[model samples]
Target: GPRSESGALDAQPWSAAAVAEATSAGRPVLVNLTADWCVTCKINERAALSSPRVAQAVKQANAVYLVGDWTRRDDAITRELQAHGRSGVPLYLVYRPGRAEPDILPQLLTEGVVIDALKP
Candidate 1:
């Protein structure tokens, strides 16, 4: 949950509506579907999303970063997971500018993976 000029992974809470708005405006958007108890999510955050290189990439891309916490049973989050054909946490999705669909990332992440996703 670090704060910086770059789009930090935990900088803001997730909002499905905001994702739609930003994408509609032609901006890249990153969404992390995490849970408090999910070990993979934490690992990905520390290894990739929180890395300096990835953060810079996000800033350079002018992307909107959002984190969805599913600590407890939340209907909206459940639906979102279902929509993506997922049944668990640590889902990573990138909605690039002008794209109708988001690019789904691996459960495990890397700095290069995130940086590449921010490419113009």
Candidate 2:
């Protein structure tokens, strides 16, 4: 796991505890599945994530930020991707707590889109 500026993507050993807890507490989990080698990933960093709206939502929603770093070759991540039916970077998955399905955000996100996800 790599270090994230926010809690969700913070340094980790890939513990689902946070996600489970959030879901248990009636909150959705927004996950940023990104890769260092991806240029679009970098763009997302500057465009969507860096926006004030995004930062505010991070704190307002107290959403757990989880980051899947595809910069390297990790078997677990690879397996997770395969399970999710994808074999690439920039996969965004938002799991609404208690819902049977998760809302998969697009490969390219903006401040408005991210904020909308925070809404119930």
Off by over 4 Å in 1: 1-10
**Could you give the C-alpha RMSD of every candidate to the true structure, in order shown?**
2.6, 3.0
Per-residue lDDT of model 1, residues 1-120, tens digit only: 335312344467777898998888888998988887999888888778878788788888988898888889577888988899999898889997677779999888999988998898
Clashing pairs in 1: none
| Residue 34 in model 1: lDDT | 86
What is candidate 2's lDDT per residue for 17-102, written digit by digit as tens?
A: 65677788886777777777889877886788767777677667766666767788677677767768888877777777788577
Per-residue error (Å), model 1, residue 7: 9.7
TM agreement with the true structure for every prediction: 0.89, 0.80
CA lDDT scores, all candidates in order: 0.82, 0.70
Taking all chains together, the TM-score of candidate 1 against the true structure is: 0.89
